[model samples]
Target: MSEVNEQMMPPKVVLPKLEKNLYEARAIKSFLLTAMVWGLVILASIPLFSVIYMLIVEGGARLDWEAITALPPAGFETGGGFGNAIVGTLVMVGIASAISIPVGVLAAVYLSILEPQSKLATTSRFLAKVLTGFPSILAGVFVYAILVITTKTYSAWAGGVALAVLMLPTVTLAAEEAMRQVPQRMRDAAFGMGCTRTQVIFKVILPTGMPGILTGVILAVAGAAGESAPLLFTALFSNYYMAELAEPTASLSILIYNFSGMPFENQIELAWAASLALVVMVLFFNILARIVGRSKF
Candidate 1:
């Protein structure tokens, strides 16, 4: 049996002394600041919660199954469900997303994977950055000047095009960021295995970056949804039921804008209810995007 000498054993390493109590207090203060920020976020949410609560209290009595299910009323003074507004919002948003997504993703892919150092990419990136900073009203004005007056009509198509412009920068920047987040090693390994650029991007990068892209799309949708100024000039508003895409269609935001100024309590209540609905819908979509983005396919 080998005799182990206690003194011969390696001296047990001692950890450096922790910083003084004052340093610990400073650390605690830093943690408290973080907690305070979270508390502020919670507090900020209160106004939205309060608005929803108030809408529920006032509009709940008027909200019957029939009222909720029925279409918009034939007359302006008469009450009706916001089904038409709902449909208009969906159609416009769908068209806009369709137009924006492909272009944005393509632009992002080029910037991230193809010609990152090229002057053309640089110019395109600069343009996208400029467009992102462009006012929504300016977008509305641009569309109005180009599509509405030139085409000589207010159309859902014009509205969609305008919204697409607004969404493009958001999607492009977000997708580029998302693609950038993918590890270079993963990309290198795929390339090392003789994978084509297209194959690596479509098969590897996009999948990994999907979560962030989805979040960006969600944000874009929410931004577009609440945009009254842009729609004011592009989508316009109609009180009557109209089936034509070329005709001005009423949106929830537009309707709220038109109705909110009325002296009548009923119309005002309707506006509140509509606003609440929009908020809830946007919140639902944001949550869905987060969940879907996080989920494995």
Candidate 2:
């Protein structure tokens, strides 16, 4: 009876297994990869935070009401602000955006959607890239020679045009990249649903790509806003509020540059203050871009 019961007992099941050394290697590799990633993250953040900390400590003390609303005081005297400079910066940046956005987005659509491999598209892309890599100072020089010299003045209009030139290639390249990121399968599905090419472009593609395009435009404007060299050649400088695009205009960057190297203590303080303001502006735009790009349709 005992022998019969033993024969009827269930057999043990065998489990599939990897070699022990293989498991150890994988675990070590994962640990190394994670450590490298965190190490790089820490390294990258240190300098950025250091700069922000310095700006806050040095500039926060002098960020007063006058700094926002009064004209800069003359050398060695200290009782004014950057009201006009802020206005001029906004005006020129506005004009640049107005010129670049529509034209750049359209060109991107033509290249990425209509004829990506065509000779014209290729040449257009190549030139856009060339412009992107072209020195910002050269952009100022080019506009100086053409618009500033032709108009016979260093005017806000010329500054805006130079910024637009700087913005155009950046916007176009980024927009093209964004458009290409839209899934081909999605386009095919739209077409399969009886959508015309125009409908597909406007209704389908544009909506999906809008956030990325907006991000590119925001970055372009942010860079242009901090530029002093281009504005120097084009807008020159104004001690008074900007009365017209046809006249000299002041900007925060120019104010910072002029003040930072001054012999007077007040000018140095104001330069630090302007630096802080410029940093805040750039940081705000960057945050806004991220938020806008992440928004749902």
Among these predictions, the greatest TM-score belongs to 2
Tens-place lDDT per residue, model 1, 17-43, is 975564587888988999999999999
Q: What lDDT does each candidate get?
A: 0.81, 0.90
Output the lDDT of residue 222, model 2: 91
* Residue-by-residue lDDT tens digits, candidate 2, 190-289: 9999999999999988899989999999999898889888888999889899877899899999999998888988888888888899889988888988
TM-score of each: 0.85, 0.87
For each of the candidates, give the backbone clash count.
Answer: 0, 1
Error of model 2, residue 62, in angstroms: 0.6
Model 1: CA > 4 A from native? 1-4, 9-46, 71-78, 240-242
Highest lDDT: which candidate?
2
